[model samples]
Target chain A: MTFPESNLRRKKLGQALMFGLARAISYGIVAILLLILFFIVKQGIGVVNWRFLTAMPENGMTQGGIFPAIVGTLYLVAGSMLFAFPVGVMAGIYVNEYAKEGPVKRFVKMMTNNLAGVPSIIFGLFGMALFVNELNFGASILAGSLTLGLLALPIVIRTTEEALKSVDDTFRQASYALGGSKLYTVRKVVLPIALPNILTGLILAVGRVSGETAPILFTVAAYFLPKLPGSVFDQCMALPYHLYVISTSGTQIEASRPMAYGTAFVLVVIVLIVNILATLLRNYFGKKVKMN
Target chain B: MRLRRFTEPVFESLIKISGYSTGFIVLLIVIFLFKEGISFFNLSPVDEGSSLWVHNSNPVKKLTAPQIKDIFDQKITNWKALGGNDQPISLCTLDELGEAFTEEQLGAKFERLPACIDSYIDSLPGTIGFFPDKQTANALKNAQPVQVDKVSFSKFISGTEWFPTSRPAASMGVMPLLLGTLLVSFFAILFALPLGLAAAVYLAEIADERVRRILKPVIELLAGIPSVVYGFFGLVVIVPLVQSTFNLPVGETALAGSIVLAIMALPTIITVSEDALRTTPRAMKEASLALGASQWQTIRKVVVPYAASGITAAAILGIGRAIGETMAALMVTGNSAIMPRSLLQPVRTIPATIAAELGEAPFGGLHFKALFALGCILFIITLIINFLVERVSAKRVR
Candidate 1:
């Protein structure tokens, strides 16, 4: 072959090799993800029984169930949502709908992004300082919820803004033309359209909050609280923290390995379910929006 | 109509308040961090209600906390080493004084303990005693109090030891933990960036639409996995793998931590860089192709350059996550608070140190404040990363 022809042939071979390498790497990532899931399920499935879900841990968390921890996590999820949802949605609305294009809007957006990037452990520190010490909540559920709420706030606000922005501008303008007020236009027209996407965001936030261990490490998270917490003022055992303690720091770490796997399985299942739900909700609503 | 008007205005005002509070909350975080963290430097490193006393003839009048730690740790064994008299230093604590005297002679309520401690210190020429202030209030005839220097920011940042609960003084040096954090995060980015960028290239350019649809949500789910679970997986899987593979005594090395963090960071890097690559205008690629460049050549020469800033932002954000990551690092990185010399050795990151140690540090105490200082350090590091991300991605927008 001529030199030029051979060079073109070599370039074609290089392109083919690069494309193949890219495809391999992409598939390799997917395979690793699948392997993680498979490993967790295989190790943990045997330990997770009906009783394990219902009964409290026994024998220093090496035996019995993680009922109290599951309940505690549920309470936290509820409490955090109560604090974050309304405020985040409102802030998102104010930025996306009411606020004009200006530095103020830019500042709020910037702060939200910065807030989203702050480490979870820093949130834990601030929560401990503000809620547990300054506010004298004393490492209770209330303190943890507020901390997780703060941690989840940016996610909620960003999603709410995106959801609200997706609603057509024509909807708002038409509502105003029919003699509706700004608040009424948002409430009656934009919100209805945006609600599903916003719900998806909230679900994703739930997934994020429920799996958080750092923010709750100091704010709350008792190592082994077999019984349920009496009230919001009481510290509670959470799934993520429970798994961490049993696996790493418990008295019989070697013996409690199965229980650690069990707890990890439960936490992963909750987060994955929440994530899958959010994805389904987003896809369903996304299609609906397109249809309209 | 009046009711609607009242409610509308009330709701609007409420949202407006919430909107403004986002910025306010970020400010509050900084303020509270400084409020708690800055106080660490103001406090003495010596334990409260305790004092260190050396022989009256000793030339060393004052020593820093770290020096005291070194003396106690026996890393500094001779008094001459610390600019004092040439004698072998002996360490004494309040409990050791109790060992020298009987309970009957010391009195039931330890009322006679003070005199016994004073006499004990007087007998030993090379002894440095750490005891309660109340014990030596009226009885320091032979022993002189060694004034401990206050904790300084320079010492705290540059000091190597991290024995926070060590007696005579707590070494709140951040260098080891900081180095460990930087080392693990650096390796994580080193491992993650290339693979993530490659996968992103596949998803953005080479993948068919159906494959992209399947992979996108999977990657999102991967991102949604909690750090704790990742830690557990690392503990059960990667730790042992590393241990056995390298023929090491234990597996929870910095390498294991880096592997876990790299996996955890992959989805974020891939997703962000994919978006950046997708933003490379189609016309740019077409022009390159029309110039007789192959698809791979066009991507490398055109798409990658166009999206370089976005890729940098992704790498920085990944670094931020790896640095700030707590539980995974805590579980798998051996929690050994030492300077990491190699990836094969166990190391602890700042976040892991805080998470593991904060539970035990008494609230409002020096150890607690030191952990908070570590938190402040972590916060500043992440903030800089975020600022860089904003700058890089903002350049992309322009």
Candidate 2:
């Protein structure tokens, strides 16, 4: 063999290049993220005060705060959870616990996956056609929330099934040994153990519905409103829709830039909070799982 | 025991209802979309405004499709272009024609309709007033019906212009929109695939445990970031960046949209590919390392090859996200419904077109159905991709 020293030197160079390449790639992601966060924060930090959060918008939506948008998003999140949580959790439990391993379960899973893959804009159309036009909901929060609730349903079912499956088999067996009915055992024993994980799923669903813009654009999002909505029938402004309007189609693009950035920052913060909560819950549940 | 027996069937039926309702909604959405959109494909003049005909006193009784398009598009501004006497053409919309008739007067037979039509045509010698076929045949007099062609399916597919509100006719071609969608999504996948794959490699085979723990959540957070936020970022940063870099008039271009979508696609690609890399059999990597291969060599030669299908799945999923993305593309792409020639040119995507125009399109109108048709196309494309992803992963399992 020719000169081991040269071969070793070439190998060292190869290793350095590869490791450096890997490090650079990781750093690239971090840098892109940091740039997005910092840029929005720097541009919008001036507008994120108490008045901005609390007051209603003014002047062709060029000035003032997005208070109704905040309340509207909260209302949407609550409405979607009300519809999606119970149905999704029940379906999840049925598929995981009651239904036997066979074609029916597989079909349900496949359908859920397919539904999840459908573009949100298609949901917007469907929502408009079904809820706004056919059902005569007439472009209100009720229609938008139902559409978004459908969007979130697949995620909830998937997560709930996963959470229920993570519960130990021994607990169920003991319940059965104590003459507990299948339904009784599942209601008290299985659900209690799966509750935290289910909550995690609901939190994630909240994050999803609150930020969605396309489905609500046609069904629910109002162009501008000076006052807060009194009922679900009324159309209301939302943060994502408000951000979209000001940034793209605002009458005065330059003047509205500050508000656009602020809206983005608020949206990012909301999503991040929900994500952090879900992550913390997941980790805590995971650790408890390992301990048990 | 009696209570348990009574409650068991109730719980069972309730759970069954919930489980089936999920599938039912998917069915309902598909049916509703198809029901509303299928009229666009009909050969008959079933679509409203499709039966509009031009009535004029000029010698020209017949016109070709291109001639009609040119006249409404303002290319044929003068009457001499169609072999008529040298005079300017006066175009009147259906609303003006309908405005002449009172509601009670139009209930049965023509009262003042013939006079209204004669006066309208007589006022301007080279006049072209458009009215529906029913109104022209039965309700009007002294005005000749100009031979008009239906807006055929072929014309809709291949026609370059998309003037849906053009007077005397509405051009409903979707070629530019389809092309723009393809262009932006293609560029997005081009930019995102490499970076996402590289990041996945680092996380899967190179990063330490501590780094993995921290970066994993960060990547998930990236995915959790809303599409609207990404659209905002594109508007504020990438739009200006592209404008300055390329020396273009405006920052909103196909290039700007692609850049934003590429960033959005990263988390999906990275997560899927990392999972694929992690699933590579440990023995394959150990064997490669034992055979005098370096850690990077093992990763490149053995791990990646083993996980090739997964990486493909990731790429397809990323493409799906790019195509389906509406809000970000709408914000950044200049919303011009023209055929895209360059990445720097402003273009409109299908989803963007729908979101932007659907609000103004009257219910059950031709323009309304056309947007739904665009939605149908988007649905079919994403459905195919989902099937491919499912098939690929299913094959991997086998």
Candidate 3:
């Protein structure tokens, strides 16, 4: 009886030890994240003032603000969304609602996955080859937007498919019962329900596009442009690429360290805010879908 | 009604066309990569409009790019070593030829430069001269052009050096960059797997509902942080820490890259593996408990085994991301294009190489094509990884 009790106690102790180890690991991962955020914010907060947000860089980018990069990023994001949104959503609709479960659907899904997996640098090369060279777009906003739009396509498509899948089939059936055509039913019933979730995906894509540096490296990002881009055909400065330049390749790497930190802080803030917004939107609509 | 009838088919076709565009775009990427990359093999390793000339009596009539580089760099100094008569190898370039003759001796337009080059080669049995092909074409009387093989596939793959800007010939050996990429990714996965697995288990099984709710989104946010920021963090924090702790000259080593990549890969591994663990049937766990097993034992023996495919997928996806990761590796890996010997050494990855060099490589030039070829290699690597993930996850579904 004593031996059996000891054995049981040993098992219980082992269980507690393993559980505690796992919990510690989980917390440790979270701690690392918090540390990164804290370190950046602490180091960068001094440089992220009003002038930093609104003025053009000065003194070889060792001083002043990142306003043009911010505006350029906004332009790239909007332009990419303009291209990727409709195509990705329509592709998702066709795949989920119309295309039969067959090789064609499977092939498209595989392609999307492969596209997502294709490193951003490859996209840069392809963009350089096709858009920049073959299409004669030069290293302008047009080429960068197209490249980034392609990068975001798979994300948008996957999210739209998931959102559309979540809408109840009875909603579609009800629309059909009222003599609505397939397109009408989808427009009236399916899209209205899936719009918020789809928007969540679009917002996340925007975050991704704004943060991406590699795709824009050759396609559009300029080292420095004295004046803002006057049109879509012109090259422009971007936030992520600017951060990379000032931190790694600038003439005043040490002198501009403060600016690097400040840029990183703003970029992180933008991405994190977008992520939080996406999460909130997802949760709110997720609850609504369940309640309905 | 007629207008609606006409528009319906048009709308349907538009949707169908959009659906097809994804695959079409992927196809276009492959086409474009090959279109630029395949031509690299057809070009000579030597600079355009330049050729290497050797004495007529020298037995080594042909040389590969690496052999020529080695001979010029004095790594191979004996003619006998290169299948020639016993003699010391001598290298002559345009500047060296200029040193041999004055402007008055060569002529005002340097029209006598080619004759001067030929006679210089004639003076030394082991001499190899590098000059423009146009200059040496009909001018060399006693010297013969060494037949340089075009860039071969085997040489490109196995050659260890990566000097794309070397004179006379650009050394486009991809081995060092390939090894560096694999080395960093291997170490990253090594660091990430255990931590990611443990965190995944906690999120899937041990964590309370409230903790899971907060932790999950936080992890997603971790993934959302731009890779460039990670690179910056690695440069500022990890690089210095590595340098001081190890007492090294530089902190931007493969070790720094691995650490950053590991951190970046963790979220993907945790999220995927947690989802897999959650899918372990509740009934299966109950059955194990009914059989007098502890919760930990049930998890270890039953839940983990059930989710093994998913965990494998997670690991592969993480590795794929690590391999393809560019900006961070570029920023922190020190960007040295040498064969990496240890984690402490700075290394250059394929993506980083392309990112750094593509700007300087002239359009439609050999260097540009070589970078495109690197892109092709990256494309294939990720392609294989994606295929493997599909296989693993598909097995779970079945």
Candidate 4:
């Protein structure tokens, strides 16, 4: 009995060491990442001002405020979401609700998976050639938005499908048993139950497109537009592109530093808001999924 | 037809086509890249002066408006065009802008030049060489372009920076940009993988629900944040920190870029790895406990081993993101076109080079296709990584 207890003590010590190492690794990762973000804010926050953001790019940099970029990003996120939401959802509904086990379903699923794996740069090239070059849009906001729409469509479809599939199958059967048409059951019974999850997925995808840079790079080539976007044809500014310019030697390199951070802060806020909202929704639905 | 109608066409083609539109774009990008970039890799000699041995367009035979501007600025052709200031548009030199610099282009030196362009620009009063977009704005005032052969000085308007066109037909050297891009991305993966893996393990196995809820989205937020923001963050924070730490004259190095990129890639690895660890059945841990094995020992020996393949796939995808990333790398990197020395040394990357220069490349020229070829290279890398990930993940699933 004494032998076993001592052995247990020694074993316990070793386990503690291993757990310490694993915990160290985890803490180290988070600390490093946050340190980096804090460093950005520390070095650049002082320079952010309304005037700096409102100015135009002068002497090869963003001289004015990034109002245009803010608007451009808004348009990009809104436009892509508007386009991706309906089509992706419809496809997901068809796959889960209508299509049974079949080749068509399999092929669609495979394509969706493949889309997630494909690099974002290819999307940039395609957007550049097809939207800007072929379509003669010439690096405008609309072209960028459309390209982003196409890029995010796959994510929207997959996430929405997953959300829809998570709903209890019994709920669907009950709807059908209660003399409900398949279409009506899907539209009313299944959708109401799955709404929170679908919304969470939508918010998550929207957050993604808002922050994406590669696809937008080739599609929207304007360095800094002085005027507000009255049309999609007019070029626009974006925070991501602004960061690119400032680092490359636009103007008052010191001054531009804060603008970059300010934009980062803004982006973080947007994402944080989305995350909080989505997490609440997911939690609400997750409880329901568990209960059933 | 009647029988087909009655059966409801089990292989219904319309149903098959539904939502396959996503596949359509992916296919088009891959095929289009191949088509445009194939010639860059071909490097074969044809009968019409289109190979390495012969000049495709007589690169040395003559100069264009831009070449004129570059060579002339350096005063290479002092006698050909006289009395031009060092600044191309200066009144004393050419008097186009103001009275500051003269237009008399005489007695320019070609020896001991800063780079190829500095002296080349001096060679001819009207000669020019290319500078990237970063240098272009100031370059315009100091250098003026001239028409050469079929290409006009107005060529800048019709063109973008892919200059594959060489007089007498010659091969273009875009390798530096491509190499630079690959190098930064490669280093980024190296720095990010371990940290991200650690986070994943911690989150999946060690953390409480409160910590999980707080930390998960923070990692995920890194994914949602724009790369440009990372780039900006790099410029202001990492660059200065590196500079001071290493006592380097400037801080914008590949290492700085890697740090920012590593941070950018953390969420991807952490998320994937967490999922991998979460899938480890609780029964295994309980069994290890019953057998008197320690919790950590069980996790290391059994849990991690089971998740190894998944972790590797996650790492590859993270690397793919690193390699293909454009704006952040373009921003934080010094954009200097040199083979990287240490992580601390400044270097240009392929994606950054393209983003920096492609806008100004003369359209349909050699430089343009070279950027496309660079894209092709990036695509292949991601493609291989993706395929490997699929194989590994599928096997693990099985």
Give me the candidate number with maximum lDDT: 3
lDDT of each: 0.92, 0.85, 0.93, 0.67
CA displacement after TM-score superposition, residue B86 of candidate 2 (Å): 12
What are the per-residue Cα lDDT tens digits for candidate 1 across B1-398?
A: 99997798899999999998779999999999987789999788999888998878888889988789888879998988887788998888877877888889788987887677767877878888888888667467778889888888998999898989987788888999999999999999999999999999999999999999999888878899899999999999999999999999999999999999999999999999999999999899999999899999999999999999999999999999999999999999998998789999999999999999998998889998999899889989988988899999889888
Clashes of each: 0, 0, 0, 81
TM-score top scorer: 3
lDDT (C-alpha) at residue B383 in model 1: 82
- The TM-score-based order of candidates, best leading, equals 3, 1, 2, 4
When candidate 1 is compared with the true two-chain complex, its DockQ is: 0.85
lDDT at B161 for candidate 4? 30
Docking class of 2: medium
Specify the poorest-scoring 10-residue window by lDDT in model 4 chain A. A55-64
Tens-digit lDDT track of model 4 for B288-321: 7787667777878888888998898888888878
Off by over 4 Å in 2: A1-12, B43-67, B77-128, B132-144, B151-153
lDDT of 2 by residue, A148-216 (tens): 999999999999999999899999999999998888999989998898899999999999899999999
Q: What value does the lDDT take at residue B69 in candidate 3?
A: 84
Q: What is the TM-score of chain A alone in each candidate?
A: 0.97, 0.95, 0.97, 0.87
Two-chain DockQ for model 3: 0.86
TM-score of each: 0.97, 0.91, 0.98, 0.76
Query: Per-residue error at B28 for model 1, in Å?
Result: 1.6
Which of the predicted structures, 1 or 3, would earn the higher lDDT when compared with the native? 3
